[model samples]
Target: MPPEKKDLRNAGRGARARTPQFVKNFRGVKNWKEASTWLEWRQIEDIECITPDQAGVARGKMMPSKKFTSNTSLALPSAVFMTTITGSYPEDGNGFSYPEDDGDLKLVPDLSTLSVVPWESDPTAQVICDLVHQDGRSVEFTPRNLLRRVVAAYARRGLKPVVAPEIEFYLVRKNPDPDYPLTPPVGRSGRPIGGGQGYSIAGVNEFDELIDDIYHFSEAQGLEIDTLIHEEGAGQLEINLRHGDPVELADQVFLFKRTIREAALKHDTYATFMAKPIQGQPGSAMHIHQSIIDKKTGRNIFSTEDGSESEAFLHFIGGMQKHMPNALVMMAPYVNSYRRLTQAASAPVNTKWGYDNRTTAFRIPRSDPAARRVENRIPSSDANPYLALAGSLACGLIGLINEEKPDAPVGTTANEDRIDLPRGLLEAVERFEGDTTLRDTLGGGFVSTYAAIKKAEFETFMEVISPWEREFLLLNV
Candidate 1:
């Protein structure tokens, strides 16, 4: 017979933290009352009320569980939206601006996202929050809220968009110095991981302990893992998520990044989502598989009743082809991000799409009619999940509205040195700022604020000189 469940509220008092063998999922709780009950059961001491900032970095306050349950809301400075990834504040003017007073915005906890921090020895729970103005309006510039707005747009049309993200990342040896390059960590065999391990079962087994923890942590948090496989690069792995609502999938991706990093640290290694973490290895990508369903009909809108591809499908592709260039900045948000876009790296250089063609910017995976979808290969793993999904969906929405058709699909490789995307960060920002249609669709305030933040980051990058510059130009000039 199975053991009876304990009345944990009382049984857990002063108990040691739950071991992996007994860890339970707490994501089913839907309100503060429910969250409090779970907290009491777990004897949680701390609660992290976090929200993703512009760079998708976790930002918020952590407080005692007692204080967390007693409070109705929390506040964070509005300037968090204007801050750059380097932790520097950009000056006013140049189309970038922030609240002069830097007033506080309210943080409303997303109870659905409440989950235990599996890595913490002391029992702790973290909840994602949504920011709102003092006037009770949603903060438009925040990454989560921006994605929410795009999802709402789909709802208005009685359609729902679904996305499954295939995120690729690397495990590398701990590098304490910023100047040095990263290398693959030594695996269980006492050897450094080598490249060309694509789909190799032995490659994945190299870090069995860390991978097991990743699975355990994900299960404890109720984050579903569809598949995990070794990719082509040394120490690189790809995790595919089950398909669901766009916003929900984005939330999972947001949490999964933190989860994977925490799991890696437990083994004294680093897991990086950087698009191009190494000089010679292939870059990582967050390939998003997307499709739309009619809310009323309960059918994939991309397919017709007879099972043939519908016009909506072509328009969606058309939308991506027409506007993805302007939207590239959201996917590739950093200077290093552009380094991953080269042809030799197998990253897409143009917006040309194809049927089951890995070289194209968009690839229509072969599937049954109900499961038909397009996979966007542009977004880097380092992209803010919320912004990347919003930018992608926004483009498709515009394409559907305009009723345009995509250019001819390429049978051969599309990365023939024909560069449709911006070559660098500044150029991407310029294109983003100049696109009035996208600006209007994604909210003008968001587009301008995002453009300004990118510009600020770019300027910060210019201040630092690279090793190659000193190596080649020191005596040549």
Candidate 2:
């Protein structure tokens, strides 16, 4: 099971703190509920602290014991307030913004419009306020922040990247089954439920009741659901989000995937974002369609009338090609993710490029003057959107900055290949590690940190023995 779903609700063996006052005040809301309230991206600062005087107002409504010693009391002052900075102060005054399609997930308007009544009136609120005050740096790590930098870079050149992401995944049986192999090995290609052929072409009604809610919920969120087609795998779906700014579209991809998972759970099913949950099945991938528009004039920079004055397009493509290997760690990021990129027909395995080629790494999806663009088919569904968009845009930026020129187009994976992308995650990370120029360009801190973090993950896998090993070797060997 992915650690994301590991129930940390009661991981530790501690009895609920039972103060008579605390119990009375709690009503029945669990501590996790309180914790969840604080999970609001920006809410990690100092909260309302109950004073001696405010006790009367709090006592007026709830319970007696609850008033003297509220359940909110369980939340420590430090726990109530999150410290975003390494030192005594917070990182920023704006507070941490958990980036998503709708910006940070604040139910209320921003602090500029927010009004804080005396927190003493409610213990629960006080805790939440403290949390909000603490996490000032959350905004820095947000997807919004990541995108903002990329968008800003484009503004300098007066170019904006039109980014549309193809989100791929499988809807599977809810919850992880222990009987299934829980080892680190992925892409085993296990069939989820019914014994059905690939892309069974089931009637719309077959999945309508299960899928309609997701589509409608997405509609309510105002997210673009451009295309929703049953993919070439059983119970798998590919959702295409409309193109927007590189960063914003990345945020939308993250949001859409999250919504799909949540909506699927409500229907007593699970949505697997694993690159390739089942072997031989079409692993999910996000093909990023990119085109640069002049920031000032709104002219498509990639457009060409007679394949002349196509310097910017060529430069952009050239940059992506040159830096792709080094920029790959940001794309494929994981060991299991590599398994998704087989010459599997559904996914692009070789790091080749061509004009409108699906089997290659990068494809010029639209060559018309009005709609000229490139589609990066390197990222897996499992990649972190922030890193993915950052790397892709970063490559484009470098390409434009250096006036890089596209070499001979590979045209196909099998043709006399010219362009080469990262072949695997480890291989890509090595390229990233070796490219000091890219590291300097992307900031040494970010590059080193990302490399180190991913290396740790790979090392963790190296330490574990898989169930497959025990199954195949335990007896036979």
Candidate 3:
């Protein structure tokens, strides 16, 4: 639990806070070596004391330019530590990153050529599952099938979900010198390439050519991207995609993340979705705009008469309210991701919702029947989109199936959830184990494997001697 407001206020009274600086000219670098040294800076190596304003700066950024109709922008940074899975530190579950790895990701043979089933099958059915395991597609229990299976369920129920994620990212330019391999890589200091234009203007017009090229590439790849826009962050930008079936949306998000990185490298700049890379600036967020459609009628399920959501929509929100704490770990699966979820400065720290309220974790936009939808505002930029979307879809299904009752919508920015999310990796694992809804919904295999994987991560973190202990507690202890 977060310290009581009084406690947090008192404890922070004498502490100095770190602030991120705004990044202007962001051109990505193809070479990781130039910034490899600083990438392992003192704080990142030893995660202790990494505030929301610090490590949150460099994970990822992706926000599309035209997802919203209003010119208004929210200035809040994402709350970092509150995510259920914010701040990832994988334990080599896949041998892809390491040779001779024993993880299951390597157990199966290459089967990309041998898909277990057509795209329309019950991705979760036992027969397809066996086929996936027989082939390499399900190797290491990759998440593709997890999402495919869920969408299949929705299809059976005469529903199809449309999901689109706001990908927010920064373009970073590097200062490289092979002679000083150990030196920190600096941002573009003095050049036309390093400055930014103001929000929604031709300011970063230098990037127009690059953005156009990206648009073409995305189209070729069958991504759902609909528009692109520059955000308030100096080098920050957003991408919006047309919504589609939830299963398709999840697959696209996975492909989209990898594609962004590859494209940025081709442009010789570093691309990141780190929630908060600079202090005193806005952080990147992955706000998911979602809607459900009746498969048979082709009408929006969340829609009400005259094009607004009815009480059924509120019940869906109720399900999110009931299970958000348990679902957070999957949404922000890394430690650094927690840095974006802090209270104050535009982040939502409470379990609340409102009409078009960007600051709330959940928001409902007023729309006509064709556009009525819900926006899940809790995912951090670094989250695994597959798992995050799955969690949300599952939650909504629960609300409708159980006809859950909901609390009154939260109306304030500062109001905090008393049941704050787990504070550490281990704590999150504990919550996962104890959550009946999640364990039951995601299945025993998923629940068990996920907990085991996360537990291994906690062990890895504990094995290290952190810089904070050396700096402030070594000799004193």
Candidate 4:
């Protein structure tokens, strides 16, 4: 017979006894402090402190486990956040140079983000943090901080932008081999998904347990997911979060990804947000819907009093078309992301705009004038939400500032339009490097640092020898 399971309710009893009085009095939670086994408990309390570097990468370290029961405060060297802005160190490499190598800076947790770890085996709680200089200034390289700056710019003009993200990802059977093709996970129905099942209710029902857990845990972590649907690819699903503040939505997207992956693992499957995890199938995307409203009037600026198209809406589209090519690095980010932007993949390859059309990079969704908005179909699900939102809002703001005029919207087949967008990661990086408008708007330091990181990642990717080379080139050449 199998051994009986231990009661988890009393697991932390012993550790609670050894915890310091001040530590037990932490205001973050009541249960955590009152629990037993403070020193020997299997439960863990961790702070999910993070800062976004120049490549739109979030990098940070967890606070020591002991710190949780010893003190309420947590801190880390500020230089930890700056090391990745440039290619000074490879993703896996340790050696890197930073201006504050002597550890003059510190990361301070923003208590507002404190939440219990809904996914950890051990009870855990975390708080997102921001990096501060030794002299107490916010770091410019921080992606979240950068986005706040753009949002403030819009606020100065009496406009507030709201965003909702539809994130698509795949559920695949876990395969240890790197070269093997991935197949769908065996669902609760005891069968693997056969092929594309776009919007099929049965496809969603197949993975009901995992999906149900995702909803439960998302709510526990305060992520307001509005809808879940089966997407175009086999075993693919999309989670749509309700539209809200840009920063809050970005945070939800970031955490939602983690929640989905964890739930998948617990249910004996793997979930991936890779832009094109499967070849010859519809690629995953993070379609962002955005609209601006007057802060005072609380009305959408994209529509007129008579529900007609407004000039602000046209200028927003114009700005997106002008800046999208340069902002490709942030939207797509990875080399694999470019693969997802191919023709016929339902992914936009050009910067054309249309009404209720999926072929264009930007589309005006059919909605009430009060709900008027632009949908950015370019960004992959693999992108960093903070940077993507920042790039997009900044571009549209430029258009609103200059009142730029957009060309006539395409009636159909935007793919046939010859409008150019960066064709690959290298081209996108070059475009980003040369563009001064995005640099000045987003920040010069961030642009240069991001360029260095992408350059390094691209060079490393080039060093890999894929199975295709050995299969075709070895015999023919």
Over the stretch 203-280, how does candidate 3's per-residue lDDT look in tens digits? Answer: 446565556556655554445577677776667777776776664565455556655766666666666777766554
Output the number of the lDDT-best candidate. 1
Residues 375-425 of candidate 4: C-alpha lDDT, one tens digit per residue: 999999988898889889988998898788888898788875564788888
lDDT of each: 0.90, 0.57, 0.54, 0.77
What are the clash counts of all predictions, listed in order? 0, 21, 61, 10
Expressed as tens digits, the lDDT of each residue in 195-265 for candidate 2 is: 23344445223567657777765654445688777676666777888877775465456556656877777
Better of 2 and 3 by lDDT: 2
Ranking by TM-score: 1, 4, 2, 3
**Model 2 stretches astray by more than 4 angstroms:** 1-143, 178-205, 305-309, 412-424, 475-477
In TM-score terms, candidate 3 sits at: 0.66
lDDT of 1: 0.90
Q: List residue ranges in candidate 1 displaced over 4 A.
A: 1-25
Off by over 4 Å in 3: 1-131, 135-141, 175-198, 306-308, 414-419, 463-477
